[model samples]
Target: MAQRLLLRRFVSVTLRGSSGPVGSRSSARLPRLSSLSWHGTGPPSHHRAGPTAARGFCVSHASGGIFNVQDQADFTDRVINNEKPVLVDFHATWCAPCRVLGPRLEKMVAKQQGKIVMAKVDIDDHTDLALEYKVTVVPTVIAVKDGDIVDRFVGVKSEDDLEVFIKKLI
Candidate 1:
């Protein structure tokens, strides 16, 4: 029964954004058509933050163009008001798919060569951000251009799809 409810919630959230505990804070903007791929039926099993670079809470593999968002202030300054389009990745350190998606996103952003910037936000550490962005799931990638959300995708996406998403943003 719990699994069924979870599936239902996930479907609703994926299809039409829903209000959660945060009440009026969820985004009204819908996910991009290209961003609608579903990789799983429900949330994956959680894992603990490890000391290794690969499994650490802080992603170290990020290059110059990619960075970890520290706070709402930083997000406002770097993302919302930035000249370049920013890809804000709302993820959790414990989420398995987030781990898989982070590096792939970094690789794709690095290829842009500063044409775009990738901001990594650990949802656990920044619950306020998660709520503000209406991120009910891990690995929610939002494309922001000139202080507005232009597109977004939830869950793990393929490299080709990600590339196309980035290209559309640019």
Candidate 2:
């Protein structure tokens, strides 16, 4: 019974706690946030937060939405050697901040058009990549170019702050 109560409390706190950008947006008023569910039963759609049916890719926001990095080789091909700068989001599905920051990031990156691209590495699925980056926390964003990390940030950042960071990379 206590375990069940603890679980309930967790859910409640999670629901009320920082959903990152969403929670911040809501602070101005009673924010009507849609359900923060990570999964859906329907087929994969570009509009949903799903990597399950992407064959590999996860959620893509705006034009620069999240791109999935399957392994080291994939990372090398897509991020390190790419002609354009790449912003890698080291995240997990269970991370509430990731959920909120991701879409907002997509929107921001989209504005950049071909200037840059975004890569997503699921820490749970790609443990090696996360460990190599020394990501002890979720929602870590890294900027890479020509096989080097140019810049990075940890945890939730305001849209303006993120935009400022992205400005440095691209």
Candidate 3:
């Protein structure tokens, strides 16, 4: 099946940290964990100006204190198994709303001060995980706790509204 092949390619790209074309317009690749060089404050290396972000695809470092989930394993540990409820942000690089929501989430989560963890998943690089989560659009926000889905929404939301939603999860 086409889906099966895509899944296989996803595995190759994700686990092996290699780029593979899974029959998609964007030949998106997963940047290896050791291949990043962080600067002050901006998008990650894989997300910089290029066909990657232009195609709404990008991968970030999981070590930069941001929840850059690269695979299902990372999702299990950083989200499902987390002591605190995790907010999963399924996003794309070319998506303007996704760009806005990313920074807003960081600021708001910082205010929570450990009460909440925000996980960012680039749908392009992690299509399998995105499909598992049933994300239909960019900027899809899902709240998870105890390894279960709780609440979710799509598009950009005001920081105040977002704070209120996160507070309830706490």
Candidate 4:
């Protein structure tokens, strides 16, 4: 009876281990979100990967919104040549503050979809662009008009502040 009990305990432990950590079911599989690649040439299309029933990219902004630029070459065309005002967000994946500020920027983009364009450049992925913009910190947001940088915020700023900054351009 003792041997049987020991075997049952071992099986329970093994089953628990095979199932992921607590709270996750063994049969549960995480859905994969689409991978976005921004090469600085322009914002790539939002790609979603998952089960056919899964929702695809759900950017809340208006159409032609949410640009992800990857390289300096792409940045020039997208930001400099664009007719609308541009807000470039220099960020990195590992930055804690950047993560916090990201959603805020998204909301800002949705708020200013027609008046301004939003682009994100990952500093870790594009070091040269970060250096050119003098981005020493993550979550640096720069406002560009007619290819000239008119104003910039080094860290997270309130939406009101961003509004005032953009208002100056108008």
Best by lDDT, which number? 1
Q: Please write out the lDDT profile of model 3 over residues 8-109, one tens digit for every residue.
A: 455444533334323222424433321221112343434432223323224543433356886788888888888778889998665789999989888888
Give the TM-scores of the predictions, in the order they appear.
0.65, 0.64, 0.64, 0.61
Residue pairs in collision within model 3: none
Ranking by TM-score: 1, 2, 3, 4
lDDT of each: 0.71, 0.69, 0.68, 0.63
Clashes of each: 0, 2, 0, 6
How does model 2 score by TM-score? 0.64
Could you tell me how far off, in angstroms, the CA of residue 14 lies in candidate 1 after the best superposition? 37
Runs in model 4 with CA error above 4 Å? 1-62
TM-score result, candidate 1: 0.65
Best-to-worst ranking by lDDT: 1, 2, 3, 4
Clashing pairs in 2: 60-65, 61-65
Please give, for residues 55-84, the per-residue lDDT of candidate 4 as tens digits: 223233345656878468889998888899
Model 3 CA deviation exceeding 4 Å by range: 1-65
Global local distance difference test of model 3: 0.68
lDDT of 2 by residue, 1-170 (tens): 23433553454354454443323543324223212322233323232221222233455445544577878998888888888888999987768999998887777888886788889887766778887898988899999977799888899999999899989987
Candidate 3 TM-score versus the reference: 0.64
